[model samples]
Target: MPDVACPESPVTPPPPDTHTRSLSRTLPISVLLFTVVPLVIAGLLTLTEGAQRLREEQELRARQTASLLAGRVTQLLASAQRLGQAMAVSPAVLAALQPPASADRAMDEPPSRPEVLGDPWLALIRSFPEVDRVELLDAQGRKVYTHPPRMQESPPVRHLTASQPPWYPREDLGSIEIGLRVTHDGADGWVVVGVSAQSLARALEPPAQDGGELWALLRDAQGRVLMLVRRIAGQPPEVQPLPVIEALAAPDARSRPVVARSALDDSAWSVEVQASLDAYRSLVLAELLRFGLTVLVISALSAGLAWHFARSLTRAIREVARAARAILRGHYLNAHVALQRDDELGLLAQSFNHMSRQLEQRERERDVFGRLVSPEVRDQLVQGELMLGGQEVEVTVLFSDIRGFTRLCEGLKPRDVVLTLNEYFTRMTHAVQRFGGYVNNYMGDAMVVVFGAPTPDPHRVERALHAAVAMRRELAAFNQERASYGAAPLEIGIGLASGTALAGQIGSPERCIYTVIGDTVNIAARLEGLAKHESGMQVFMNQATRDLLPPHLREALQPLGELALKGRGTRVPVWGLPEGAELPEPPAHLRRPEEEIL
Candidate 1:
């Protein structure tokens, strides 16, 4: 049978709307969210907590640095005090501090022990570079001698005590000077030392560690910034102000500057330590950036993998859908899906392919089975409705035979005879099936057709008569085609009868066929032989079939009084169609091409 394309099957639902999101797009999104969202949230939380802890640590460090610097300053002052006491009691300074031996001796004259005092004072200055200068004062608290001899003398120390040192500001040098009284061996004098503010600031600065910056400043009792030290990462120590450093920072950069303060004991001075938060800030930012990059990479990989799998899955599904549609359109042979995979989808594909192969095999068997019997019987058998045993049915049987088929075969080769029969049978079968009849048997060039056996039809007799007329017309066209081929034309006679007959599978289990066996079938074959002998008739029918035809078709039948013999107990009445009778137009498929007629 020709394949009929069915756009949509009644049993198959329509596909989803195109606007709906496909698995390919939705899968990646789902996977990205499933994988990346938590990572990003966790990263943000880690960064936040780490930054907080880092700031706290830096602040604590700053406080510790401030306390350390305060203690260091106290130590430095104590050490200086000890050095001054040592120098004050030394013989050279005591001698230098003594009054001039006589009034006559010029007061402007240098002390006799000036070299001794100068040498020790210079050595002290060399040992403690923080000390800029040293001076000697007399018991009257007057400045008398100085190392690296000053051009003019300054006011001497007042209220100097042996137990407590006195500190005085040196405005000219941006420093402070302290006086230590000497009482050893009744030497009443003071040894004064000058301390550089810059040196003090450098001494108080903390060491660099972990990429942080520490800024230290020495403030006096008046709150003046006497000295400032800046220790920044990737740079040398500087003395720039806090405002300048802040201005140089990026606008979006964030840092928590922690300040710690400590007082210098007995000096009315304080040290402030400020720690830069940018060190840990930069580290946190770098970590955040790395985390962000990791998240992006993971999300991208997840999306890519999801897309790949979704594409493979959807592609396989589409292939299966296409194959299923092919099956619905009756193209069983073409219904197949090709997918190479090891996953569940592969298994599905295998199952679908196996199903399609089974369908194709069944279709092939159906076609081969259809060739042996009529398509109607094949359908009945496929539907499991036709029984193995015979059943009585009111069947209208039409029997047709070629008048000179035996003579025609004698004149042709065996191959030619077979081809001729095939062509002739092909047209006849089409005519018979067109009117709801199926060829039950083919006896050489003769065909026995039945209607209303497997399927009941009230118009079975009318349909059988219509089929007889259609066959007569098809034979005329067949003769025309033979004439075109320069072959001899052929003739045929048809006989139809309607009666209760045995109809069903009528053979052994090894090889079975569906056919009818009754007087009606015998009578139809006898009428076909009788038709050829009639002077002007092409078709004959018994009384039972003629009576069943409608009025219009009944009026067209010519009366043929029956004279029957073989297997009949009584004479039977028959009706015939005269040679000159009107042959109705052939079945609608007559207009089809010769190839299609097959």
Candidate 2:
């Protein structure tokens, strides 16, 4: 079969994109530190700390106001009880309760006459104006006489035993009933006074600025709402049975209620002072207004200070940002921030300048290095895949020489010589890199390349062989272009050998380089020299490389009779690949290793 270029493998995969520019613009760091961060923090503190403090103050003031109102109600009830105690033992009250001469006389009273039953009790009630009505009960709990009787008949107060004289608050009558026992010479009786609810409200009100009108409730031990002061018009004449007055109000919309237990002897009643939350609401509003003002003042001052500090940083930072934008556009410029201060911003600017210089140096080195090695090898070295120390590994060595270059250069100008070699070497280098081969060194007019050093390739032999063939073919086209430029066409000889080799960083620490070295490399160099002398061919492959080629392309090689080389002890099988030729393979033979031309 005629010599043909190997089928093109998939193009070498590019390294992944690790970093990219953000598409959306964001707030600058200065703004974040100065205005935004402080605002957010202040708002959060105002909501949490300010609100909590206001709520706590409201709760405390409500409790204090409730206690004051409770004390007032207790005082009112205590005074009424004192009057009842005095009236209980009065001679008039005692005489009035005694068995009368006739039942008709006891009941006899002109309908038009409304005089006090007796002056001793009347005078006492007049003195204590809160005591609206008074009644003297017989030992059997029957009403004997009542001053200004509300009803023709009234039921006895329950929840009061003979052994205990109880203070009862009646919800149905809207009054407080105080019961006191009389024990003079064993003639026992009970004096009960019904103090009006209207008088109780007057006594329950606190100081004008303290809070709203205090509505007081007297409850028994059973948590019942027994009496409500000011139960007159538009008020519920009776308090319903419930655990607390809140049960009567809509949920979360009731007055703040403060309570105090009765100081009376029986201790059966309690006074609750219920008032609106308007006073506490006012207090909270005033506190919040002050807090808001403080926040505004502090925020303004903080922002100004923050900007002062941030301005120093932002100058350097903005320069860095602009420099980065230039780098993204392929202009590797430095920030060059000339901050004179010995602060972090100054250090940052210095670091940026140093990095920019490093990047500029690396760009030159990368271009020189990449021309010699595939990007895959570059990435492998960068990622530390190949350690600095040497390791034994199999690799393919390809050596190519510019044929007739020494003679061709003698007739050309010095500038032409360099331009020709540069163009020729560049084209050939590209061919090798396409097949994962790297140009390791340039020996005058000759080029030395290696396959699978930094990154080991299992198919190194075939790749080297393919790259050699590609280089041979690309040279023909390059020659045509050179002829058009009024320059002589170019030609080169390639020799490939593959075997176990020592491959790693090969030089001193100051200028270390990754390379491959062994007899395999030596043999490849010898093969190229032999191509110039004996057969003067375009490409040649040693036995080691020939064995690895695919069987179909192996037929493309033509066997030239074995020739003794300069140094080794054996004669080796050799094959030739002249460009555009159809060559038939020779029968297999295991020739002894000889100097293929040492």
Candidate 3:
């Protein structure tokens, strides 16, 4: 087949934006659209969904409350029946039933064996405070016993029958009375107890703080609302049933009520809990108000943050450009950008600063060393073969962090805090140097020191321990001075670990740091954290570090047990030295002090 030349596809250009906007102006508007607009839309949707959810929750709550009330009512009835059954079988009631000696002998004469019934009735009333009255009637419907001896004639024995409903309204006495028919040893009568309607009404009413009304109805087997009880928020219970309960139960357009039914034995009785629709609406409104306010505050913050970010970004860029121009004009020392941020832009600013510093250092070297060394010698010194990677070397790492430094600084001015840290670090550095240790890094209120790094040391572990003890001694002296000035004393926790780690200058070509890294460094840091929380001990070390100690020194160390440190899978055994524990004096040649360091 002959090869045919094919035409290349034309590249399509994007549509031009005639009007370009500055980031400082575009950011706030874009943020408002992306953040505020979405938030507003979400708020509206949330309000709608929240209202529906709240309505459903209220209905569910009403159903649960109604069910609870029904359970309570059932319990009340069951208890009353049990009490009645027990009273009917009592000897006192049976004695009262026995032919009341000489029934016709004297109408007003004190009834024989009155004390028998009287004692039992009084005891029954005393045992159950809710029992308003304890009444015993005979088979002939004759009232035989009453808790409180009645002076006048007792009300006609109306509710003393087995055929009557178990529970009935005592209109004459203004109470709801429930009775149990008793037939024991051929003795038949009714054991009746009266319960104050108001008490029962109060039990059915919801708590006032709930901001809802409760309406409890007691209906007959025929579904007639026999007893209606109503309670509004912050109001006493209403035991009197209105002529029509439907009027009281009528709900508004927004009303949603939950109805629950419970039957007492065979008695068809139900309890209904109707939470106020208005209360549900109020709750939903309150929640929406909080949501709206939160959204408003967040939107405001987003806009402010966007504006600030745009302004800072542009300002930093401008500063860098200006500095670049200055550097081009041979003003390397003066060309620098100062920015305070932890983000990418901050890194850019830092890079610029590093570049300026390197340039200025090179310029100074040329000016000062130019006359002394040859051009070739100067070049070799300036651009030597740098160790760009790390090497595995056994070193003893010491990590120390100031305890309560944050709290201490809270009470001191920023300048005073800086001065205090400088003084503290100065003493600590002297202590480490006295034991032939190099202070590696200062991270916030923490310090990392290394022994046997960049220089071989056979006794690195011993030196690290000596340095830790010296640091403790220095801190005590420092604290005494602070106490004399009525200032708060500071405390520090030290952790030492000895192991093989990657040690060398590590970083980008622009900026490098000679530091150690590996599991040993991590263990030291973790131990440092643990020491701060440990009681009686200010210094801690891993088992590996402790293993290197001599028997005499090891005997003084307290076991810290196996600990599950973070970022490590296995539990590491640790040892600690009490604050009062001291090591033997160092060799005469190793007795260099702060004065010698100075």
Candidate 4:
């Protein structure tokens, strides 16, 4: 009947292909969230705070300017008042009141009219630059003396009036007069002090290049613009009339009626202090522009930083992702991430590299373990080995020793001895491995090799014997090469036995070795010792090993009579090929001892 084929098992599908792609996608997003977002938010907050500070600064500047202008106006008004009072108290007017001392005083009385008496007073008033024109009036409503009287004809004055009695109807003086009471011999009479409207207007004028305007207006008790300063001709028509009167009319006015005032004025003779809103606004606007520029610069810098941080974060994430992929692919040596910042991203990269190194170390350990154990045993040991364990098994053991190694070492320098020994061990180890034997351990120039414990071979005995012959042949060539360098020829003795041995790993768990321990191992070592001492040739085999060989192989072996061995009370028979027996020679450099003899 035709064989019925079993159905093949279903192959498991691989994991989703998007795993790495998903990680890459999330990296950029995470960088944006962690790096860029906070930077933008902080930049915006800083801009807002800067703008607020700028606004406050502008407001404070405006208030200070307004206050300074108000103070200037108050000073101007106080100066004007002091000049008026000094004019009112003139010594010239007082002298006019006293009678002439001589007879000529009668004739000079005509020259002594109030006009002559007021000359000095008028001159003094004109001497002051801020004063426009000064005039003195008698109580009869007629001008008695004047300085630049023609100035009174200008349009600024509504009307000029004479001084009158305090109780007289004030309207009769046309309400334009400055009524100051004169006291002579304790009797009071009204004296008029008239300032030219133009002169007063000029006094209120700021310097032509002052870039600001100042004005003063005189008003009656009823609040009229009796005199208006006309520094700039076209004053606002609406402002031509006195606003102080209207302000004073309001009962809620809090400023003292006769004190200096700002734009908030409420007195008949109020002074209005004004500074240009345009100039102030220009300053504020300039500051605002500056503030705006500052904010823009800061925002630009912040954006640049944000971009830099974002890119840095992105790069770090990419590096980490790349490293992780490489590690997953079993590439350990070059797995690393870009270290960009001293922040979390840098720390993450450091951790990823460290983890990769640890994984690499573990993988290296696994490879070393594979080399140490047989494949079957390695699998079980990797699963986890027990320290307190061993197994008894039938196996073939081979022992090799360099004959007269001590004498050779004594004759050579320490370095030369080590070099020769290493070379010999290297050749012997290669031969033993080729024959499927494990080199259990080395004792100076001696080696213990075993077969069929970690990995069992049915023809282990034959393999060990074959390896011993190969080793002899290889060592001969090694020595022939050394002889050219003035070095002695190398001779190695091999001993083989087959028996049950206790085998597994031996020594402390931390530093254990896999080897065999039994009578078979002891016999093999004893045979190798015999080869070094009483040998007819370089290799020896015990009777047990002899029994294991085929008849044709046995013919190749030459028997030596029974010899007493240490640790054993009985004699053991040993055998070897004769020194002159035909055996394949390696190259001239690798000739055996027998080949060298020929």
By lDDT, the best candidate is 1
Error of 2 at 236 (Å): 23
TM-score of each: 0.48, 0.46, 0.36, 0.42
A best-first ranking of the candidates according to their lDDT comes to 1, 3, 2, 4
Model 3, span 11-40: residue lDDT tens: 334333432434434343555664676687
Model 2 / residue 49 / CA error / Å: 11
In candidate 1, position 283 carries an lDDT of 79
Question: How much lDDT does each candidate structure score?
Answer: 0.72, 0.63, 0.70, 0.57
In terms of TM-score, the best-performing candidate is: 1
Which of the two, 1 or 3, has more TM-score? Answer: 1
Q: By TM-score, is 1 or 2 better? A: 1
Better candidate by TM-score, 2 or 3:
2
For model 4, the stretches where C-alpha displacement exceeds 4 angstroms are 1-331, 339-352, 363-381, 508-511, 533-538, 550-552, 579-598
Off by over 4 Å in 3: 1-386, 589-598
Model 2 regions lying over 4 Å from their true place: 1-39, 45-317, 323-333, 342-344, 354-389, 505-514, 529-538, 558-566, 581-598
Candidate 1 — what's its lDDT?
A: 0.72
TM-score of 2: 0.46
